[model samples]
Target: MTTSATRQQITGARSIVVKIGSSALTELTTGLDVRRLDALADAIEARMRAGSDVIVVSSGAIGAGIAPLGLKARPKDLATKQAAASVGQLALAHAWNTSFARYDRTVGQVLLTAHDVSLRAHHANAQRTLDRLRSLGAVAIVNENDTVATNEIRFGDNDRLAALVAHLAGADALVLLSDVDGLYDGDPRKGDATLIPEVGGPEDLDGVIAGSGGALGTGGMASKLSAARLAADAGLPVLLAAAADASAALTDASVGTAFAPRPQRLSARKFWVRHAAEATGRLILDDGAIRAVAGARHSLLAAGIVATKGRFYNGDVVDLADQKGQTRARGVVGYDAGEVAQMIGKSTGDLPADFRRPVVHADDLVAL
Candidate 1:
């Protein structure tokens, strides 16, 4: 694990993604916080002027809608929440537009759903659109498509969406601006708690208590950590900081937790195949199959599969299970469930004349 001071030394990041939570966007008394919004826009414009590309993933549509709709608090039901989002999204964009107008910079709204990235074609298109927007010198503000997304279809929070956006935009770094300063070893409210500056890998924070943020924000420390993992896996460094300290964090002032990127970067296709896609079925494999698929990095073969679970079509994502029923990996299966069932336990050479391709190609598999 690296210390906070060490992480703060990372500078000169060319492209960055900054995510701000709803709590940081709204006023405590009523309506939106114009000062903070303006300050954030100014900071982003400064970065852009300094030759860095900046993308802002902002959350506040529901919070901003509360005052307009006369709602006392955030609505619990999904329908009401969506209604708030619909009303608030307009206000949110208007706020950014107004703020950025001071510097004569234009802002573009990009709403997305998890499914947008789940499919390969949609993901590629989204990436291209965002890249084009940045190249045109416009600030791209992204938010989840809350108006139409159900609980099952939602990205859950903006943290995950920001990480995904970072990957899509090929950002050099991700800055998650929230209410808290950074991740801590213990809850910050506790007297003995201390900030955690750098996370080398998953094992560093074994028993850290990641407490909930506040009522206005859906994500907590846990979600931010998960976001860090996602960005890190994609080889993008992540900086977790307070929304108030966005400028300092962007300047590498060591005001937040920094999750360093892994040395190896996964291909965009593999990243989408592994993390973005939802698995539709499971295939149980023997020990030999696990070693061949995971250890040797070979494609799954019908002979190694012992059992199949769930109904999945060809090209659907499926989990590879071991003999004990534990999932060892996930991949897109080349054959449908019915076809795989007929070919299971049969040697590659013994397969029926029409079934000869690899069960799950190496290009599709992602080790869990």
Candidate 2:
């Protein structure tokens, strides 16, 4: 695990992804806070002018919608929340569009649903669009397609999406701007807590207590940390800072909790499979299978699989876990769950001719 000294590498990254949570975006009870949004745009434009391709991942559709719908607080039920998002997404995007226009910068709104983000083909399409947007000198303003998404509107926030976007855009660094300044040793509301300047790995976060989301945002500090760690593991350094310090955080490395990236970066495809492709099923492997798949880095054999879980189709991502239920790797299953169930524990030579191949090819798998 490296220390904050690695911040030097992120000082002037040519490409970066900056994410602002709903809490920061909707500090005003009325709706989208224009002043804060404008400040953010100013900071982003400055970076773009300095020769960096900046992509913004924003989370405020639900929060911005609360005021417009006459709701006194965030909606509780899924339908009401989606309604708010339906009304709010427009307000949020329009605000973003107009905010960047002040500096004559074009902002392209890109909304992604969970399926659009996780599937292989859809993920590739999004990656291309973001890359092309950067090349055309436009900022990509990404947000969840909340109105149509089922699960995402609840537990999944834009922080995780930002982590995924960082790699999709091939960003050199990621900056997470939220209400809080940075990671703290304890609950930040308490006077005795101290801000943590850097996080090397899980060991450094042993006793940290990251609370849940606020009334306006779906993600809290816990989600931000999860997202930051996700990006760091994919070999992208991340800086978690306060939305008020947006300019300083982007221009320098001293304002926030800087997380060091892994020494080696996984190939873009592998990284996508590991993080973005949400697993649709699980295949339980025996001890020998775990050793071969995780330790030796070999293709998964149907003979090694002892059990299967979930209803997944062929070519869908699935977790390859051990009997102890620990997922050792994620891979694109070669067959449907029902089909895979029939071949479990059967050696290739002894199995039916049509089911003789590896259950998961090494080329389509990533060890966790």
Task: Name the candidate that leads on lDDT.
Answer: 2
TM-score of each: 0.95, 0.94
Q: Give the Cα-based TM-score of candidate 1 against the true structure.
A: 0.95
Worst 10 residues of 1 by lDDT: 1-10
**What residue runs in model 2 are displaced by over 4 Å at the alpha carbon?**
1-5, 152-155, 352-354
Alpha-carbon lDDT of model 2: 0.88
In model 2, the Cα lDDT at residue 333 comes to 86
* Overall lDDT per candidate, in order of appearance: 0.85, 0.88
Tens-digit per-residue lDDT, 42-74, candidate 1: 778877887889999999988888788888788
Candidate 1 positional error at 213, Å: 4.3
Q: Candidate 2 lDDT, tens digit per residue, 1-368?
A: 23255576666799999999998888536988989999999998988898889999999998899898888999888899899999989998899889988888788989997788677788889999999999999889999988888964323889999998899878999999999999998997977898888888878888898888888988899999999999999999999999999988877667879988998877777887898878889999999999998988899998899999999998888999988898899988899999999899988998888887789998888898
lDDT of 1 at 336: 90
